[model samples]
Target: MPGLAASVNTPFYQQHWQQIHLPLLKQRQTELWVCHLQCRVPAIAGNKWLKLKYHIQHIQQYEKTGILTFGGAFSNHLAAVAAAGKAFGFQTHAIVRHDGAVLNPTLAACQEQDMQLSFVSPQQYRQRQQSGYLATLQQQFPDWLLVPEGGTSPLGVKGVAELQLNNTPAGAADLICCATGSGGTVAGLALGHPQTAVLGINVVKDPSLPEQITALAPHQHNWQLAADCSGLRYGQFDAATLQLCLQLSQQDLPLEPVYTGKALQTLLAALREGHIKTGQRLVFFHTGGLQGLDGMLQRQRITQEQYQQIKSAELRLWHQFG
Candidate 1:
């Protein structure tokens, strides 16, 4: 398999899933493992680095000036790209979707990384997929490589397919799961692990997600999408989801509610509802968005106490490998 070059500097780590919070996991005899791709730059941790890996390579290979992408003001994708641009020596720009350009922690980090920001209204943002708008962007920034929002391009899927998540210390997983946003990661997983079942716990309530995944990994039929248990909108989490994130932190698996926590909550709901088979090995990809905690706290979505609790868990988890 073509893997990420050594220079990207992402180290892989696996942690056996341990959380008594979900009692059904024990009753079902399901072995769960969590895998992380730890990047020194932090924002590129988890699926971010893998998804952006090839995009960066394309820029370098083709001699493109930098990366031009689209995202919301608090988007993890934008943060990752900005950090990547700074760490890897490239310029970065983002077409941000928002009625007002508030300097949230995520956008602030992008600026700190020297990423240029251009705010667009939600109506204008909706035109991102239109060919006319894309052509205009191409004409405006001729030297820049325009990446899709959430990094779900063909090259992004190619990069994500290089991840080896089926292997655990115990054995190979019968099923693999991840928090699916733009479908690239799940699609890539299906392409990479054709023998295993891939489940995407969709954080958004988009009925078109399965079709999106299908479009990305057209040759593979090993993947499916499941709705989030809370049925919350993208970037929104309920109180129960917040509590679950705090509870899981006790097991040293830090997760943000918008993606990872919500997805795992849905997965646990499935296991408890008898949707998952017993005696099967499952591996969950921890798609990191810990950087979003600062934004969550700033937006008052999570209390300062909750933020400290979850952030501490992340600190301890990383220190173990240090």
Candidate 2:
């Protein structure tokens, strides 16, 4: 692991194997293909199902294990961490943002997974990597093993690096695309595939992200950022974009109105603009966000009736065509 400074959890791999990766490998048999999954938190859930089972089993062999701590209120990371903790008999602590008093859906999910929730002011939460802050928490929970937020550390990157192992579809993939929030997943991918170009589709409007990515993996080139804002504020969505998200969701590739949807939009736009040329394989990482779909649909005022109608029509059309 190149970035993790803490004791990393391994149960996520098992969860991902069961939920996402195995199905993906089974369904997708093309030589040259595209992956729309990004580095969203749920992506970790899928990864957990696909890969972490063995690691969990191995960790069980060792004694003197400690609790794993990570994440914020709305974070799918928190949910995954919580689930992983419960399954592995490790105590879990979640550091959540102090935006509000109420727990978000993800935090509630974490609660169900038996993760203890702790709230810190947004500013203090931002200082998570600071020595003073971490030291205080370390002192408080001496037995707790820390995991970096969003799991962007060296150990986390090690988990992500598994994506590149024994998983190529056949022909050379010209480009690998992902959405970068903390930059660890892309960093791991870049490290794993030095020859293939890695493209990051940023959902946030962070001007410093390119430099951040470069800093994370200085030795790796052929990685660049695609600046397509799509008029979304971070974690916020617009009408047209929400429509696109709904459309994509209807296509069985459910995407949230946040990062993954924007990344998908960027990828499609790149294809239209000739940036992602035909015959050049593009793999868009479909980082998981099925949970976020609830918030997105709620915010967009998308009704269940409408969803049923649309799905029904699409199914009918598909049946007719097939």
Candidate 3:
């Protein structure tokens, strides 16, 4: 309850853009509205807070000591759980997929939040979803609530469903879009706004994701998934996507390349390809993971100039809204 209370008090803002110089959107006569969820704990911004808040409430209700979760070395989910734990007074532990010998900026941030980390081989990490493996984890950490990777469980979906993304400044959005990694956010949107269509740009190549989303919101049929346009691996992004993120930042929208940028790129591509129809309002949830830019910079996935450009935009937006 303390965690939920703390997060509920944080300010949230929405920025709508209809004047971008994109010919595709103009030709389609579509408007894009972005909901930027600002959290007191920066890492828990955007969908992270929406996904994790109910999990924290559940642990508190059941009198659990803390949370034990799984993620890759630079996972935004892990960073979010760590920050939420620190902000709300819960112990945190993570089973991380091994990426390299050293800690990246994301992992370093997790440690700063006092999140206990245990690295595992990729093969072992894949077993996280198995019932037997989950049983073992429960036996090992009996007092901690075991949250699914990316917080994609029912509780996570429930938390995300509380968002009112359909109600834009002008009117209700005809379509709601988000970058779907684990499917929880899109599922929540579909469940929350049964009248509006929800399109999730699948950032990962996992074939089972659609099925996973269906399982999460079985009665909801208003949602669909589209593959990422880049055709690159989940963590790997192309230069064009990076360029789009930079361009949008100048318009006062700070987007990171991994999820938000790739999603907007795919959405714009859909508009160009005539997949999205004309004269509709679209609300894209800027599910924040801008902190991952630091990890990207540390791994040389982005240049110093690119990092500074994005960071400067983020600082400006935060100064105005945060």
Per-prediction backbone clash count? 0, 34, 0
Residue-wise lDDT of candidate 2 within 1-322, one digit each (tens)?
A: 2222123442222211101222222333212243432222332444333233323333454542544555556676666666666655666777788787476567767788778887888887888878898899888877566766666665566556657522444445678777667677777788788888888887766676677667767788877887655866667666666676666544445555577667767776666566665655556665665565544344445566544544463344334334
Clashing pairs in 3: none
Worst 10 contiguous positions by lDDT, candidate 2: 13-22
| Model 3 C-alpha lDDT per residue in residues 1-322, reported as the tens digit of each score | 2444445434432433333456667788888777777776778888998788778888877889999999998899999999888878889999999976498899999999999999999999999899999998999999999999999999999988888876677888888899999999999989999999999999987899989999999999999999999999999999999999999888778889899999999998998888999898888888988988998998898999989999998888777763
TM-scores of the models, in the order given: 0.94, 0.75, 0.94
Best prediction by TM-score: 3
Best lDDT among the predictions, by candidate number: 3
Q: lDDT per model, in order?
A: 0.85, 0.59, 0.87
Order by lDDT, highest first:
3, 1, 2
Candidate 3: Cα lDDT at 25? 76
Off by over 4 Å in 2: 1-44, 47-70, 165-170, 297-302, 305-322
- Model 2 shows how many backbone clashes? 34
